[model samples]
Every structure is written in structure tokens, then in C-alpha cells.
Target: MRSSTLRRHLGLKHEFQYRQWCKANDFTSMIPKDVKIRKNAAEAAAASQTIIDDHAVPLPRKERVIPYSDELFQQAAIEWLIETDQPISALEHPRFREMIGIAACATNGVKIPNCKATRQSIIALFKKNLYDLWTQFAVSNFCCYMVLSAY
Candidate 1:
């Protein structure tokens, strides 16, 4: 097979491995030096293998594992709870925990905050948002005052 055809096949059949190889080395230099085809052996192998319909075979699902941060997750959860008007106690509910566990797919399951922890997170978030809003308001008012004084 031509070098281009072989590269295309590798890219399609072993995409992840091909990408990793490309990242580690120049792809052009990585191509095999020898390209040979035994017609008899190829024909025998092809005859022995049964052809299957593509529609009959289900494609494998790829799962990407992303690093999890407890602090970020807790902050996001607290914000979502507040936005949805749910009680802090909801974080400790078995059903809610189960749902999070299923969604997170962590080996040990995600650690959800208890009522007290949830309340604390909520308070922290509120204080941060309030400070941000106050700063914006103060800056805008100062700018307005400066413009008025200049006039």
C-alpha cells in the first residue's frame, strides 16, 4: 500500500494511538520503511474471515476521564441549588447523591456536601457575588460622578 493510504488507514482505525505517536514524533518519519503485501496470504485470510454488516455491529463508546476538583464541584453544586431554589439539605438526600454518583462515574463516587457544608458554600458564594456586584456599582457611580464634575 502507498504511504498515504497506510497513514489514512492508521488515522481511521487507531486514531488515539496515531495521535499519541504524532504528538511524540514527526508523523512523516514514523512510517514503516518496508511496505509489502503477500497476495496469497492476504487472499487466504480474506476468504477465512466472514464479512459482517456494519449496521449489525454497534460502535464502541469512548469515555474520557477528566480530572475532578472537589472545590469547583461544590461551588457549582451550591450555585445550582440556589438557582433552582432547592434546600441545602437536598445535598444530603440519598436519591440526589445516587444521581450525582451515576453522573460522575467516579470509582468511589463523588463526595457531596452535608447540610452544614452546603450552607457554608452557599454563604461563601453569596458573599463573593455580593462583593462583585458592590464593586461594579461603586465603579460605575464613581465614573458617573467624574463625568458630571468634568461638565
Candidate 2:
């Protein structure tokens, strides 16, 4: 049977729904708890990319995170942006860009704002021109208020 025809018949919400049906009928041993959260396929392709294995460490107070001064983080982000430019969205992912900026700023004796830029365009601008980006978004947006705003 064609996939579209099957889709028309079952009217499952998505691919995972069919997987759930399979699991319920004993086609598989277990159903994933968070099937909605798809794994990043690009990360799998980049075998050299370091997977952050540290999930157990508790998030410390704002002052607790060791500031990024070593330049290692910046280098990695630059490598990705410069070399492949594959998924421009990495520059867009708030989590990824913040990590890069936090590490870079901390190394420069500047505090990594508890908040960081959210818009992808602004984030890209930040990479190209820091002062201009700061002027437009207002540096205050990336300051400690971001923690509360983030929530």
C-alpha cells in the first residue's frame, strides 16, 4: 500500500503515530517516552562533534558557571559557521549561540548576560558586528533580566 493511502486511512497525526500503533501491536519492545523530540540528524553525521555527556551537573547560581575565557568555545562555533554553513539555524538556535557568546564574552572580562539575543537575525548580526547589534537590540536585553525573561 502507498504511504499516502495509508496516511489517508489511518489519519495518524504524524509518523510517530504509526510507530505507536506498531508498538502497541507488539512490533517493537518499547515506545519512546518523548517521541516528539526528534534526534538531531546533523549531529549524528558529525561524528567528530563532541556530545555533551554531562547531564547530571546541577545548574548553579548565575555566578556559578565558570566563565569561558579559553577561546575554545568560540573556535568551535566559528568552525561550524565558517566551514559548513550547512544549517544556518545553529546561529539561530538560542541555546547554541548563547553558549558561544557566553564563552567569548566571559574570556574578555565581560560578563555573559544572564539573557542573550533571541532573534536569529540579531544573533547573526552579533557575530558580524557586535556594537551595531548591541545598539539595535539594546545590550540590556542580554543582561541579567534575560534569566527572568527566559522563563
Best by TM-score: 1
Instruction: Report lDDT (Cα) of residue 17, candidate 1.
Output: 81
Cα miss at 11, model 2 (Å)? 99
How many backbone collisions does model 1 have?
0
lDDT of 1: 0.77
lDDT over C-alpha atoms for residue 144 of model 2 = 53
User: Which residue pairs clash within candidate 2?
Assistant: 69-107
Quote the positional error of residue 28 for candidate 1 in Å. Answer: 89
Q: Which portions of model 2 miss their true places by more than 4 Å?
A: 1-79, 82-85, 108-151
Question: Which 10 successive residues of model 2 have the least lDDT summed?
Answer: 29-38
Summarize candidate 1's per-residue lDDT along 30-69 as a digit string, tens digits: 3332122345567889999887776577769655554679
- lDDT digits (tens) for residues 1-151 of candidate 2: 5754655445434556766787789764122333323344444667867667775576765544544544965676678787976576777788876875565556335453343544665687768797776676776666757877888
C-alpha lDDT of candidate 2 relative to the true structure = 0.59
